[model samples]
Target: MRFLLFILICAGLILTAESCKKECHDRSNPDCENYDPCYGKQPLTADFETFEVSIFPDNWIPYSTDTLASSDVFFRAKEENVEYEWTVGSETITTRSFTRKNFPVGVRIPITLKVKRKTDFGCFPTDSVVAQTRNIFVIDGYENSKVAGYYQGYHTNNAADTFTVCIYIPEYSMNPPHEKTTISGLMNISTCADNKINVSGSESVGYKQYTFLSQDGFCHGAWGRVRVDSAFMGHIRIDYSYLKDLTDIKSQVDKTFLGKRIN
Candidate 1:
């Protein structure tokens, strides 16, 4: 009977060792049947880019969604055939690239990326995205004296909307004063919409009635927003950081805004 007990003990030891490893026999390669995903996972980032703390934001929610695309202002990641999900400011998409046409121009938005990866046999787990890029559109003369100048009135196209614009003299893009500008502004109830200051980051601000030169002479008109029903009067707001500062882009764009002149 002692010998019989010894044989049973050896059998139990063999079974325990087998459970600890994977076998090529199962389709899912799980130690047990129907085992869940991530029972054991290959280290992520091996087949993808390494994580950099400085590139991603600390808080994830209200993230602005975007993708890896190639353009003058955007840097596109070259990875393909790999699954990924992008979450931008409460929305999710499944692409790896985007263009200026994809989002509202000149707005700064937060973004997030999730890579689809195999965490178990026949299963994939979504991993955090691993890249970053600019979140606002850039244009020539975007911060020019015309569009950035001040005005007082309502969008002529829409009677209900009122506006008061103020543009300071074109700032010195250079230390010695190259007559450049920056992108920043505030709302007021008084008259101060006639300065020639240039600002950066956004081109959404404008005045069309007076043919401002900062507009690159294109008559985008005196519309705070390109859309007639867009932000009105002191209602236009900007994300100060989203402004871009390039020394070129001084040309006419396709959009136009019509509004009354402020007193």
Candidate 2:
């Protein structure tokens, strides 16, 4: 009886070991059905492989939404076992929107996005992307100058020509003490039709009419010069303003800047 009991205990132990072995077998290994040498010793593949990030509108604006259009910007993480972080060097941004009371002018803020992935073995690798945002002010020069600039080009059917407005700053000047200078401001235009003006052939066409201010801070001023480009048409109808300001500077751009399509 003792010998029989010992034999039964040994059989139970052998069966338990075999059952565990079968349960943990590697299906990829043909010999795993009976004996898997690689069982419990399998290699691991890193879960994280790739990721992507992006910013919306691809441009930054410094004025209030009522005065200027706002854009949405964001970044995304696409890998497993990965973590993400974002930082802006100057202004505080919330989910891609600037939240500061005032954006510092003439400053470039670096936006950084970082991604880190961890391997099964506890090894970590990192990736990063960086961008920048510039601050600028908008000034309205057309309202200050009463001259209406007309749009003239081959794409008139789809394009409407009107006075271009820009932001102005006293600091901008072509020469001398560079006293108070007038720059362009937020763009608002008056079509020719709105002003009771006639549209002729490839000549000149107008759509709307709007009042502009003067250089002396007056409400009504006539434009003095007119300028047109692939992107905008400037009319210096108001003495306080000019047809257009320098395009190389950000402060010179207004709503009319969007009208010009540069090839």
Candidate 3:
């Protein structure tokens, strides 16, 4: 009886050792059924570019469900024979490239690209899933100013109140034509497009409308007429008011400034 019990214990230990051997096999082992060829490697990358398409506010709403203006974005993949998954805002698409035409202004929108190679299991090393994101900005006609760059000038209301104005587009590479102005050095001022100004002129360099809110709670609204001949020059007469409430207007201060593009 003692000998039989010893044999049974030996058999159990051998079975346990065999199970451990199978479970301990690494991906490099060919005999292992779960071997992986693309272990510990990122074999793919997702990349794309963007372009902007601006439209008038009156004719912007083509669809009832659409949010903002439309943009023509061109996306491209670096690798061939791969599956693509794109997430633009709340929408997902499997196409390699498509024009996404619904985004809001004055905000940053995220565009994501996820990809993986689609090949035979053992034909080549399996590619790991690669995901990349590029934040985009969609601009209306006002934001898409051709005179988008740095400028140097001073406020004409007060001689001692010197300031530098920067009219720029954020994330210039991925978004459509739009501009954001920042008046720094003297006082910190930011662009405020709460109220749109209507102006009629040439699309390239004519009349551009803008609104600015300073740190001192003053809202400045004006239209700047830019001339692009030998140099980029513009003058603006802005009516500023201390905006305790944006909905209601009261006391106002009028100021003027002339700016030249240094960059």
Candidate 4:
């Protein structure tokens, strides 16, 4: 009876050893695919909460970047009365949202969000998931702004070519955008137009007040800030002291002139 009991015990031990072989396999072994380190571990993921900001510049500004622009960004949780700490640069504020304005244009800032259970709510002193904050940028690059399209500038009713202004924005992929606030500045003044214009002797561009145009909307073309008089509300008028004589039948341009912004 003793011998039989010993054999039975040995058989039980063999079965137990076989069951633990998978768990005890070498972690470095390439063939050990049965081992899973995260089988019983819970997962933690970081997230960023999207909040609406009242001060973000969604459209292009017609003037300076110093103008006040405010927006709010914050994080929220499903728990009631949850507390949050917002961090940006070296500053940390204990609020659910933050508002900022006058940030330097072209500067990118990173923000972080840390959350904890509020004392008012029944919660433990444990830290919750901290999410990464969104990066921000100020309104910049008005000089190289995107103002691409065709326009007809008529300063006179007799002839369209006499005061016709053709605006063309280059392909953004091949060439960088150009900036100018004047008719001559936006054109290639190096070459003359069919001997009609002296490239070196064209008129200059002038700036005027947009309000004087008495128009409802505003347009800031590559020619810079446009100045439209009340009489030319729908169009731009320039009083050229002399004809540009720069004739381009291909483009239907008559004269080239220098101009200044009235504002």
Give the best candidate by TM-score.
3
Ranking by TM-score: 3, 4, 2, 1
Off by over 4 Å in 3: 1-43, 54-72, 119-126, 140-146, 149-260
Q: Which 10 consecutive positions of candidate 4 have the poorest summed lDDT?
A: 210-219
Per lDDT, what order, best first? 3, 4, 1, 2
lDDT tens digits, residue span 98-174, model 2: 23233233334344444443333422122122232323222233222112323222222323644334322222345
Clashes of each: 41, 46, 4, 22
Question: Compared with the true structure, what per-residue lDDT tens digits does model 4 show for residues 1-263?
Answer: 99999999999999897777755666445446555543443322233443323332222122311111222333442233446666767787776544543446566667566666423222322335445565654424322322222235433434443333432222224344432222332333333232121111111211122111101111111122233333443444333222133242243233322222221
Candidate 3 global Cα RMSD: 18.4
Tens-digit lDDT string for candidate 3 (42-125)? 456787655333232221112111112234444555556678898876788887767765456657778788987654455344
Q: Model 1: runs farther than 4 Å from truth?
A: 14-29, 35-71, 81-137, 140-177, 180-263
TM-scores, one per candidate: 0.23, 0.24, 0.34, 0.28
lDDT of 4 at 86: 68
Q: List the residue pairs that clash in candidate 3.
A: 143-178, 143-179, 144-177, 144-178
Residue 211, candidate 3: Cα error in Å is 24
